[model samples]
Target: MATTRKQHSEQSAPGPVAAFARFVGCGGGVGVASSFAVAGLASWIPWALANALVTAVSTLLATELHARFTFGAGRHATWRQHVQSAGSAAAAYAVTCLAMVVLQQLVATPGAVLEQVVYLSASALTGIARFAVLRLVVFARSRTQATAPAPAVRPVRAAAPAGPAELCPAA
Candidate 1:
């Protein structure tokens, strides 16, 4: 049987606040890992370049995490959703790269510490934006599930009691 949009919405996992919190947690973990990767690569590559590479990798990682943990995409994920996810990732990478470039110029030459600070700051902002896009656009199906009304429960009727005269006559 086909389910109504409202019924589907009620079945979606993770309330908005819960989803956002999960996204933040996942993004935070990705940020930490990305920052470390960037720091490790900074000595070998240009700071901005290192950040860009790490940010790109991290964004991809985040997409999967957000899909699974934040939005419950599971097997329902579609190519369209993948495209939206990629778009969000690109936006995040762009913001991170731009922030690193600006930070590098502001400071004569930033060390790993300063670069990490800037990178994390950029990641924080990108996380918020990514959450919005992933929820409202990438996972639009989930949003429907989130907002749909709960299914109406049918109450069961009780069986009628036997009359006292019928019970006595049966004996």
Candidate 2:
């Protein structure tokens, strides 16, 4: 059987916090699922490299998903948005890498679960930053003249004539 996606109106769009939560949930699912697949090979390659690879792939998928679902930019996805996504992904990866370093120092042999915990904590922290960048920078509403409202017209009042001198003379 075939399935369909729900249509969302711009005015009725989800709030920023709601959208961010959804985006993270969707993106986190992709990240965790793929990370599990990569975790199996920890012995073969360095844990950090494995985590980095997972982060790259997961981020690519997450950004695409966010563009479609969260920002409502499905067909209108722009190169600028994609670049911002890449930047967010890079930040997430860097944070995870740093966490990996700290984990490595703390334990001689970190298990997959332990590494996953660290990666997730770092990702959660970075997700807030990503949401800010994406909302305020990438998909921000433009203050273009076209969308701006026309200025209101005010009626000009005529100035009072020099009647003060005329009144004094009449008195």
Stretches of candidate 1 off by over 4 Å are 1-10, 143-171
Give lDDT tens digits, candidate 2, residues 1-171.
443333222333456777778777877678678667567656689776777777767766777677666765444446776777788888888887888889999999987789778877887788788888876777665212213456899999997887877768854
| Model 2 regions lying over 4 Å from their true place | 1-11, 41-43, 142-171
All candidates: TM-score: 0.70, 0.70
- C-alpha-based local distance difference test score of model 2: 0.70
lDDT of 1 by residue, 1-171 (tens): 998754543466677899889888888888898889888897799866887787667766777777666775443445677678878777887888889778868999777778778878988898888888888888877557555766899999997898988778854
What TM-score does candidate 2 reach? 0.70
lDDT of 2 at 20: 79
